[model samples]
Target: MPADKKPNSRTAMQPDDASRILVTAIEVGDIETIVALYEPDAILFSKSGRAMQGAEAIRQDNLGLIALKPTFTIDFITATVSADGQLATNRMKADLAWTDKEGKEKRGSVDTLEVLRRQADGSWRYVIDDPYGSMRANLERR
Candidate 1:
């Protein structure tokens, strides 16, 4: 999808639907579809733990991944909806495969955490996406 083009009208009526749409968009390199899945001020945490916020930043970040022509399989762990039914949290593991610049296939997996909010239109969109959310990083005690 072109950067200047309008995003797709796909709506995530269920939390898991959002995950399905996301993985499909990524696999197909549909930037507009991927961007449309996020809220305007959404935040996305990269594999390196760098944070990219807002639509533009998120768009740019995903563009890099799209360039890799990656494919993914998402295994959903859990999804918890708030009592008010307006917010949800999701945890999943994404197995990724892509070809590097040298044309060698690479494979890896990452744990993801996503926060989704129900829009007034009754659809869900991601507000926070952390690709490495489940990783236990090394930390030093003070």
Candidate 2:
């Protein structure tokens, strides 16, 4: 999947550029632009125990969250990229407060363990996008 697809206008991301893409998607909620950074037929094995592939699946999965946290943003104070800058594993604490489908006001936070992989294009994408370590992170925390 080496993206030798002409230099053109797209900036060649420096390996761990996935963070920028991820952050951008969260901030803007634009699935098309975000998925463009990844392989056309990539599969995401999410930590939520959801396995999704292609643009539509990923888009819908993210859209489902918006009803809860309409505007998602990461507050990563100590997110570090790998030595080669090809991967990044972060421990981020996120907070979201919203009314659920049942009209219940709830505040929640998750300690995340996110993983990113460098694609053949030298740009990084979330191959295993584990934004939340597990439900346990939310359940165990008081």
Candidate 3:
């Protein structure tokens, strides 16, 4: 069965719920949804090692990614919540597929790490999103 290309309507108010929302947002090519999942001062580390800080910068970066029309599936590997339950970390393996500029289908796998914080409204938002963390670690092993 093919995956749905729409963001889940359910609100991501919990840490465990954020990953699914992230994947769905990307799959649906919704840049606003992607930005809303992050903290206002969050930082995103791109695959090319570019650091995008704050929601505006992250939104701009996500706009470029949305232009690619990428579809994503994330498999949660592990999650650790802080004692206070205000901070959490989620590690996931992601499969991504997209059509290239030449209309050729491209696919790849990545391991992602997200640090999320509980907001005043009790919603979970990522403070740091590093989608290429595993790739960077692998390269460092060489």
Candidate 4:
């Protein structure tokens, strides 16, 4: 299924919930559910670190990942909400496994960063999602 161009009602009530829901959706390869986690004009970063804008673009990019049938185990590190409670950031560590084209299983871990906004309905949706944001986090750990 394609992205609906709008965040679905099945959204997060808290910042960490957004990350949890997204990882779960990806694990199950639920494209529709995954797209629903982002805002219509959200920015998503591809595995190659390319920036993709809008829902359709995000959906197309995610299709590539879904094809790999990846599994993720995420441990949320921190969730900080703005003083006004309208914006938040979620930081997490994700261990991922997927089958390569050669039918070999590959595994890796990365830190993920997501920025979410509180919708009019009080639900949280991602405005920016960057799986590769771990580069900076990884460097900091060094």
Candidate 5:
């Protein structure tokens, strides 16, 4: 689907649905869809150890990722919704494939933690996304 194409409005998005949609958007290099999945004040903990806040910053960071033409799969380990159903958290394991700046294809795995908030319209959007959430612990164990 084109980046400009909005998600289907008929189904209300759950935390898992939001994650799946994000994976699809990234695979298709759909920057618009990716940004739409986040709340206006969302924050992303980038791999470079910087926090990217708001839609514009997130968009700028993702542009670099999208330029890599990455292909990836997200295996959600867990999703827990708050009692009020307005907030949720998810743990995921992802396998990614992309071409590096050196013009070589690379594959890697990552652990991610994501926080989502329910929108007024019943859709869920990401409030915080940390792609390297588990990297430090994993590296320490090795």
Candidate 6:
């Protein structure tokens, strides 16, 4: 995609469900809530550079996220849906902090791309999401 190409990819039914789930999944750190917005076999590509497949994978990550951070805020700069209304992607800048095993808290801002898949029920879920958008570059070889 060229800079002047103006990449606007979104569907008519993309915004409502995709925006809500994207915000809730990160803002509240609720995995189950996020999962409810997804298809049972959806795949997740996280910015942390991990590929979590299915509800079970999402559940495990969500549980750890809650326990580790408990609080995190996500801000969306822009988001768009696929033309078919089956996919939506968002650009989020996150502000978060977590306690390490050594009892120290680590915090920072990371650039990421969140990809959501709209289910058959008009709901949205993460199909291949990422916390750090650049992680995909690293995943290419794997």
Top candidate (lDDT): 1
Model 2 TM-score (2 dp): 0.59
Candidate 3 Cα errors over 4 Å, as ranges = 1-6, 140-142
- Residues 17-47, model 3: lDDT tens digits: 7888877776677677788898889999988
Pairs in clash, predicted candidate 1:
none
List the candidate 1 regions with Cα displacement exceeding 4 Å.
Answer: 1-9, 136-142
10 residues in a row with least lDDT, candidate 2: 1-10
| Number of clashing pairs per prediction, in order | 0, 0, 0, 0, 0, 10
**Which stretches of model 4 miss by more than 4 angstroms?**
1-9, 136-142
- The TM-score values for the models, in the order shown, are 0.86, 0.59, 0.87, 0.85, 0.84, 0.65
Where in model 2 is the C-alpha error above 4 Å? 1-24, 37-48, 119-122, 134-142
- Cand. 4 TM to true fold: 0.85
What does the lDDT read for residue 45 in candidate 3? 92
lDDT (10s digit) by residue, model 6, range 114-138: 6777666564665565666744576
- Tens digits of per-residue lDDT for model 4, 27-80: 666788788889999999866677899989989988888788777776555889
Minimal lDDT window, size 10, model 3: 1-10
The candidate, 1 or 6, that scores higher on TM-score is 1
* Model 1: lDDT of residue 135: 69
Q: Alpha carbon lDDT of residue 2, candidate 6?
A: 24
Clashing pairs in 2: none
> What does the lDDT read for residue 103 in candidate 5?
93
- Candidate 3: global Cα-lDDT? 0.80
Positional deviation of 138 in candidate 6, in angstroms? 7.4
